[model samples]
Target: MKPIYKRIVLKLSGEALAGEKGLGIDTNTIMRIAKEVKTIQKMGVEIAIVVGGGNFWRGVSAKEMDRTTSDHMGMLGTVMNALALQDALEKLDVITRVQSAIDMKQIAEPYIRRRAIRHLEKKRIVIFAAGTGNPYFSTDTTAALRAAEIEAQVILVGKKGVDGIYDSDPKLNRLAKKFETLNYIDILNLGLKIMDSTATSLCMDNKIPLVVFGIDEPNNIIDVINGKKIGTHVKED
Candidate 1:
């Protein structure tokens, strides 16, 4: 199937990479995701990924720790995830590059907008790490920022468990209704938990469309890009 968007930023939560274990990277899970990514890459779509570090660390969870320190540690965790994902993709013969906001020159290239775009133009997958090199910001915000900088057509968010954006937490309330499509203002006003307010606002201001969907099912990424409509699409109404 043909991909609807020429370029996209895939926002993956660290928990999604952790799979059922709920912590740390799951080999089988990452491999499965890598294979799926390969499929889409072969479809001639430029892919940039912003992976979270929640599997390794979450600043908010460390209530007693200094917020900045905890957040910095969280950023390092993202770099680790980026390397693992880069390895998995390379093993599949997909050329991938890891760009870190917090530079580790020996391991990854520093975040450079033009270089990233050039990599995408060359059909190389670029994985962004380190959460904007700032404390208190989330990987979701990083995705929005990078997408806006790279001028991507859409942000495809692969959520860990839930299928799409709901009126309330589906796990907590089974009766919660799912929204197939929503506007940016609706997300802001209703305060959906899909992405942080800062990230949501950035997407809105830039007019970037987003698709929030479940990552559990195989081929969900491919399905979303092929326009099967398996997720909640957010855009300007």
Candidate 2:
């Protein structure tokens, strides 16, 4: 099957990497994700990844800690997740590179835009970590920023349980409405939980499309690439 998108930025929440336990790294789950990623790469699609740190730590949720310190810790968590994913992908015989926003030469290469794009051109999956190398930004913003830097065709948001953007929290409100299609302005005005405002605004201003879908099912990443319409699609009106 031909892929609809030639290049994509996959936004994965750290919680999604935690599997059913909802904490830390899940080896089996990471391996499963790696296999799926491998499948998509084989389709001749350039893949770049931005992973969140919600599973290991949340900077905003910790009231006692200094905001910057907490955020830095969160960045570190993302790096750990990045390394884990790198290992999983490498084990699958997929050439992968981990680039950290914050310099960690021993483990990950420091993020360089031209170098990252070069890696993608060579069919290597690049995992971006450390959340923009700043304290206040979320990984969602990182995904948007990286997508723009790499000129990605779209951003594929791989959510855990929820399949699409809803008017309210679907987990809490069973009556929440699911939107199959939406515009970026609607997302910001309606305050949907699809992504942080910064990330949404970035994609909107750049006119990058987004596909939000569940990662629980097999070959979901592949399905999204093939434009199977299994999730909410946000784009310009």
Candidate 3:
């Protein structure tokens, strides 16, 4: 199917790349995600990716440690994931670029809005790294920030545990109501925890659609871009 948006930011959890064991990099999962993104790119959709580092590390995981140090550690983990994704994407014949929020000249380009968009305009997949380059902020917010800055049409969030946004935790409550479609107010009121509040507010303020879906399913990114309606879509009023 044809993609719905000309440009999209695919947000993936670091844990999602860990596969079933939930530790370290999962090659199968990474390859699957790469192929899915490639499918959309083949159909003329410009893809930008923001990968989390929860699998290897997360700032909150080391709550007992100094917040700044822990956050920097988490940011390094994101760079590791970003490099892995860049390798996978390039292997699949997708022209790719990696721009780090924190400068790493040898490894990636520094995050420059115009340069990243230029890469996309030239049909290269841009992978954003380093998670907003700030302590205590999540890669989720990085995705939203980059999406907004790049003027992406939508943020396709591939979740690890849940299929979509629900009033309550679906696992905890079997009868938890899932919304096929939702608005920012629903997320704000329910505190759905789909994306961080910062990320949600960023999208809401910019009118960028956020589609949260299960990443466990193969080709899910392509499925979302293809307009399959496989997950909950959060939008602005």
Candidate 4:
């Protein structure tokens, strides 16, 4: 099937990589994701990833430390996740490059927009780590910012538990309504927390579409790329 999107920014929460343990890297899950990504790579999709650090550290949750320090720690955690993913993808013979928002020359190359785009052009999967290189920003914002920089057609948000965006938390409310498609205004007016307001605003202003889908289902990423409508699509009205 011809892909509807040539390039995509995959937003993966650190918790998604944790599996049942809910903390640290789950090698099996990472490898599984790597294999899934390998399939997409062969489809000729330019893939760029923005991974969260929630599995290791969440800045907002750590009240004892300074917020900036906590956020920096969270960013470092994302770098760890990035390295683990790079290792798994390389094992599958998939060429990968990790670029960090923060300067981490020993591990990842510093994030350079031109270099990142060039990497994607060469069919190398680029994993963007360290949430915007600043505190008070979520990985969701990193995804939005990177997507804009790379000019990705869509952002595929691979969620952990819930399949799609609902009026209420699916895990909390049994009667929550699932939206098939929604505009940015609806997301803001309805107060849906699929992503932070900053990130949502960025996508809205840029007119980039987002697909909120469950990663649990096999081939869901590829399905999204093929425009299968397996999840909630957020776009302009």
Estimate every model's Cα lDDT from 0 to 1.
0.96, 0.94, 0.89, 0.93
Candidate 4 lDDT tens digits, 106-181: 9999999999999999999999999899999999999999999999999999999989999999888999889999
State the displacement of the C-alpha of residue 69, model 1, in Å, after optimal TM-score superposition.
0.4
TM-score of each: 0.99, 0.99, 0.97, 0.98
Q: Write candidate 3's Cα lDDT for 97-147 as tens digits.
A: 989999889999999999999999999999898999999799988988999
What does the lDDT come to for candidate 2? 0.94
- Write out the backbone clash pairs for model 4: none
| Candidate 2 residue-wise lDDT, 95-201, digit = tens | 99999999889999999999999999999999999999998899999999999999999999999999999999999999999999999999999988789999999
Candidate 1 residue lDDT tens string, 85-194: 99999999999999999979999999999999999999999999999999989999999999999999999999988999999999999999999999999998998889
Worst 10 residues of 4 by lDDT: 216-225
Best by lDDT: 1
* Candidate 3 ranges beyond 4 A from true positions: none
TM-score-sorted candidate list, best first:
1, 2, 4, 3
Instruction: Give the CA lDDT, 0 to 100, for residue 63 in model 3.
Output: 64
* Model 4 CA deviation exceeding 4 Å by range: none
Candidate 1 has a TM-score of: 0.99
